[model samples]
Target chain A: MILTVTLNPTLDKFYWVDHLPLSLERAEEEILIRARKSTASAGGKGINVSIFLACMGVETVAMGFLAGHTGQIILRDLLEKGVTANFVWIEGENRTNVTIIEKGREYHPVKIHEEGPRIPSHAQEIFLRKYRRMLKRAEYVVLAGAIPPGVPDTVYRELTQEAKEAGVKVVLHAGRRPLWEAVKVGPYFVKPDVREELMVGDMPVRTEGEIIAAGKRAVEYGCQACLISHHVTGDVLITPEGIWEYEAKVPLTKFKNLVGADDALVGGVLYRLARGDKLTEAVRFGMAAAVASAEVEPKMCLAPAAIEHEMRAVEVQFKEGL
Target chain B: MKARDLMRRDLTSVEPDTLIYEVVYLMEQSGLSTLPVVDEEGKLVGIITEHDLIHAALPEYFDMLHSISFLPNLNQIQKRLKEMAFRPVSEYMKEVTSVHLDDEDLHIADLLIRKRLKQIPVVDGEGHLVGVIRRIDILSRLIR
Candidate 1:
């Protein structure tokens, strides 16, 4: 079974409105804006990947620090969808992240994310204990998402060390301090979260050459493979074997929502890898899943047939000696 | 606190065409008194409740009778349940009133008291079910 760790989980709520007014005419006036549609789901990077894996008939466990009623909802949603939840309960309530989408500009969404609950030392200890036990049954362990407050930045590095010692492949998906620290541990795979910034470590990813350089730097730091997002429709993969660029031919207008596409890519790749597929084929299939997910309104498309149909649109180019 | 803060955001709902047996299984597993029935777009259409189950199990003529002692056997009720087990929830579920997520706790309490409801579904501006608020939730928050 694959193991996924999401330290901070949230109830992701989305509202689609016809028009989002930037300013109010009067401060005292109560302006009531009705949404055209809305949806709520359990979300966290690892949680999303676990859900995607479960949808593809993969055995996976999602571990994290959950709390209060929102945490209960997150667990229920994961279980109902067939992802095993082994969350350590914390003191405060889990956060609720909101996303506001306008009518025409569905591509650009306004996101308001909460800081989430702090992980008390007791909770952190409990999580580490549970994670250690879970590693025995895991073939691949994915440490994804942001570290909650009160937890040390070395959390991912520690997790990577433990998973590697257990002979489990560790996939580190994060950004900022956690990514910088965990890369030094030489995880099996690395996917930096560039939503906040384009730089991976100190290397800027503003150009294609810079993106490849950053990916190469991660691989040189002892990572077997590193994948970085080149753009919305493409990604760069650097490995000891070679470097490959995977791009979807589909137009940007086809995308309805881009929210969980990255998780789908990772989940799809892990699903294929767990099935003993080659890394090249796995990454290709994962890209197709990402594109398929972006074409739908839901966070990630779970249908196997849809992903298979999308595979025809992905183009893979090989580059050796990068 | 407001409805958004107090309401349970984890929605365990079934589609309108979902079979009765599956709904019962979900309700039994989740310990929910009612499950909201949504359409393809997740718009709340109706709700199936324990009361609805009892209403569906009894025969139309049984409403006029005082006791079940007069019945020959309990097979009649069992047969009724078996018949509707594979049927859709839309046939037996009832339309329900819902509160907005931004609605005040006081307003929700007033509605709960006036309508004698055990729980109320919370919706967004588009009438999509976002959460559920139970009376016990309100009382527990008061104590906390």
Candidate 2:
């Protein structure tokens, strides 16, 4: 079974409007914006991946720190989707992230995120205990998403070390400090969440040359493969053997929603890996899944047939050296 | 606490064509006391509960019996179970009593108490199953 850890989970709520007001300067009085439609679901990088994996008939267990009413909703969603839930309940409510999507501009949704509740130290200890026991059952453990307040930055680093010690492959899918700290432990796979910025430990990945350079730096630290997002429709994969770039044939206009596409990609790759597929093949399938998810209205496309259909549209260009 | 806030949006349901045995298996696996039955279009049609399954397994004269000595052997229940296992969920599904998304908490609680319901399905204007409000879900708020 694959184990996914989402340190900070949220009840993601989306609102669809005809047009989002760019400025309130024209308003003379109070403004009341009406949404055409709305939807809510559980979210967090690891949680999203587990949800995707479960939809594809993969046996996955989602672990995380949950709290209050929103956490209850998140847990219920996981169970409903057939993903086993093992969460550490803490005080305070889980965050509710809101995204406002415009009619024709679904790809560029306005996001409003909340800082999750502070996890108590005792709760962290309990999580470690549960995580240790869960490691026995997990072939791969995904340490993804941001760390909640009151938790140390080295938490993912420690988790990676523990999973490595247990001989379980670790997939470090995080960014900034957490990614930097955990990558030092030599995770099996690294997927940086660079939505906020294109930098990895002071190394800017703005240009193709910079991305390859930063990816190579991660490989030097012993990551089997490091994936970095490029141009919204493509990704750069750096492995010890070589570098490969995957670009989806679909245009930017085809993207309906990109919220959980990255997570779908990660889950798809892990699902194939669990089925004994080679790393490159798994990554190829994962990229297709991401494209499929991005092209759909839902946060993540759960249909295997649709994903397979998108696989043919992915152009894999391999660069043998550098 | 309104029905919209109290109801759990994340839940599992079964299709009407699903076998009784499969429903029971799902209930056992999910540890759910009650399961909603929805049509192909996701419309809330009926519901099945553990109580309903238990009642289905009992002999027709069970309610009339005054003594345990008249009870049948385990073989009788096994036989009944075997026969009912293949039956479709539509055959055993009960008429679902549900609440609208805009309903008040007091109204939902009253319905649950008056009808002795373990859980109440939450539906949209078109009778689509959107969420579920359970007795435990309401009680859980007290501790929180």
Candidate 3:
């Protein structure tokens, strides 16, 4: 069974409209009268990954900080969706992330990211203790996304180190400080976009070659594999066997949202890896999942069919000179 | 057994001024028998139950018609039903009640049962509604 750790989970709300006019009062009637679409789903990087894992018929447990009414909603939604959630109850209200789409127009899409509830020290301690107990049963532990304010960046690093010592493969999907700190403990896999890598290393990745080179450097820094995802260019996979570059083949389609693409990639990669696929195959599947995710409407969990179609079209080519 | 141990953590509450129809929908959606009414400041003010709703569904002249009724008049029934369907929750809800939190002692249950209350609002120290502890919550704990 896979164990996904989301330090900060959220209730994601998506409000969809054909087009959002610049002026509020003038456009209010039209936006409301037109085909208005609104949906609320349980979200957060780890939870999204667990949901996809469940979709793929894998047993997964989502553990994290949850609180208030929204927290109950998250737990209820997870149970209804068949994903087991073991979260530590905190004091404040769970944060909400809203995605406002102007349908096909890129200029009008508004994404409001809220900082999640504060986790008191006692709750944080309880979470660490509970997570350690749960890690005993997990084959793969995924520490994902932004750590809420009160949580130390070293938390993920601590979890990664413990999981490795306990013989559980740790897959980390995070940005900047947490990602940088977790890598020091030698996680099984680290997935970060080019921007995150540049921020952590204080160096820009100007091209595909530089990105691939940077990924290789990440492995040298202690991660078993570094998977670098580039929005337009595709993904670069660096492992002990060598470097493999997978170029995304699917054409850019109408995108609904890009909120959970990284989570989709983590799910895709973990799904294949846990099933015994080689590094190259896992990276290919992961990239396909992400590209497939980016093409769907906002807040839509990546459908398995979308992943399958993208996987069939994905083409990976090896560059010369190891 | 304390109220905290058996109170339903997942509660569906409504504002004191919410429309009765919306409360009915919320009741159906949440599968709850009663709803706690709260003020904007999160203080519990009242509670509404299904029985109160049924009473609110009766004709204004229901008492007058009782002397002659083999069957109530259709117009009166229709008017009563419409009123019941649209009345605000505040109009029908029972105001003022004993409320306790999970951390409170089991003696709170004894006091509530002796007072003939079906339910009590489980509130935090600040008086915000957190959940509701019914007679069943206590009964279940006793059985356990």
Best by TM-score: 2
TM-score, chain B, each candidate: 0.90, 0.93, 0.77
Query: Model 3: residues >4 Å from true position, as ranges?
Result: A22-35, A106-108, A193-198, A298-302, A320-322, B1-144
- Considering only N, C-alpha and C atoms within 3 Å, which residue pairs clash in candidate 1? none
TM (chain A) per model: 0.97, 0.98, 0.90
lDDT by residue (tens digit), candidate 3, B40-138: 555678889876886666655657775436554667656666776767788889875655654554666776778777777777677765556678767
Shift in Å, residue B13, candidate 3: 25
Clashes per candidate, residues 3 or more apart or on different chains: 0, 0, 4
Where is the poorest 10-residue window by lDDT in model 2 chain A? A23-32
Stretches off by above 4 angstroms in model 2 are: B1-144
What ordering of candidates by lDDT runs from best to worst? 2, 1, 3
- For model 2, which pairs clash? none
- Of candidate 1 chain B, the 10-residue stretch with the lowest lDDT total is B24-33
Clashing pairs in 3: A256-A297, A256-A298, A257-A298, B4-B102
lDDT at A289, model 2: 94
